[model samples]
Target: MYSIDETYKNIEAEFKPRSKWDQGVKETALAVLDSLDMPETVLPDHFGSRRALLLNGADNWREYSYGGCALVYNVDIAARFFTPSEMRRYMADGHDASMAFRGEPLLDLQARALSQAERVISRYAREH
Candidate 1:
C-alpha cells in the first residue's frame, strides 16, 4: 500500500513485530472479539486504536509537526475503508479523536474499543 521509494524503508520498520506488551494486549483484544463471536472479517476496524499506537511511538514527530499538529495517515488501514485522497478530503489523514487516548494503557484502550465495537454492532443488529 506504500509507494516503492522512501516509504519502503519505513515499511521495513513498520513490519517489525509488536513488543511483548503490545503483542499481549493485541492478542487479548482479538480474543475478546472472538469470545463474542465477532469475527474481524465482518466487524469494523476503527482508525482509533491504530492512530494512538502510531502517533505515540512516532519518532521525531517534530519533523512532521506544524502548529503542534502533524498529518499522520496510516494508508495500510485507511485503504480498507477510504482512499488516501478521500482520507485527506475527509480529514481522516490528520490527527483525530484518538489523539486523546495517548499514554493510556493498552488494556484500557482495548476494553474501550471492544465496548465500542460491541455497542455499535449491537445497535446495527437492532436496526437491521
Candidate 2:
C-alpha cells in the first residue's frame, strides 16, 4: 500500500535527466528485467542478464525508433491467472483507459508487480 507521493519520489530519482543523445529506455527496460526472477527458458539472449518482471505502458518498456515507439508487457508463468488486461488493471487500480500513459519507471512499479506476481505464482503452485 504505497502512497502516490512516495511513488512519485521514486520516479523522480529513477528518471534522472539524460543527455541529448541518451533516451533512457533500453537501459531502464533492462533494469526492470534485472529485477525479475525468471527461468532460463524464456530467452537465451536475455538469460542471466535481464532480471525484473516487465509490465509495460511505462518508461521502462518504451522504445522509440523508426518514427514510432512501442510498449511491452509479458505474462508467461503467470499467464493463467489473468489476461494482460486483467493484470494491468490490477496494477492500474481498475481502469486501464490510460495505461499507455503510465510512464513510471521500473523502480516505482517493480514492488507492486512483484507482489502481484507472488500472488499469481502462489496460486499456480498451490493448484498444480
Candidate 3:
C-alpha cells in the first residue's frame, strides 16, 4: 500500500491543471485526494472508488481522489466501523474546503458513489 506521503507526492507530481485557471484547484484537489484511498479503476465519471474500497477494507486498493468526495456508509456498520460525523467535520475544514466552498460537495458525491458500488456488489453476490 502506498503511504499517505508517497501518495500525495505522486498525486502532486502527476496532477496537472486542465486549464491555467485550474492549477490551484487541481493542486488542492489532489492534496485532498492524496490524503485518502480511492481506486482509479472503478471510479465513476465523477467519483472515486478507492475511498469506498479503503472504507470497506478492500485489500490492495490504495488510491484516492480530491475527496473521494461523496460516500455512503452501510448504516449497520458505519457508526461502529468508521467516523462519519468526524469525516463530515473534517471535510468542512479540510484543505479543499479552505480552498473553495465547493469542496463540501465531495461528501454528497462520494456517498452516492458508495451507494452505487454497494448495489453492484450486492447484485454480483446474488448472481454468484
The worst-scoring run of ten residues by lDDT in candidate 1 lies at 63-72
lDDT of 3 by residue, 12-100 (tens): 56545464224434343443444345434232321245345434443222212223332223222122222555435435544443222
Specify the highest-TM-score model's number.
3
Worst 10 residues of 2 by lDDT: 62-71
Give RMSD (Å) of candidate 3 vs. truth: 14.2
Best by lDDT: 3
Query: Which lDDT values do the candidates have, in the order given?
Result: 0.33, 0.32, 0.36
Clashes of each: 0, 7, 15
Better of 1 and 3 by lDDT: 3
Model 1 lDDT, full chain set: 0.33
Is 1 or 2 the stronger prediction by lDDT? 1
**Model 2, span 7-30: residue lDDT tens:** 223434454435311223323333
Root-mean-square deviation per candidate: 17.4, 16.9, 14.2
State the lDDT of candidate 1 residue by residue for 1-128, as single tens digits: 22112222332333243443334333333333343332333332344543332233333223212212222333322332333564465454465633422454223344443344333333332212
What does candidate 1 score on TM? 0.25
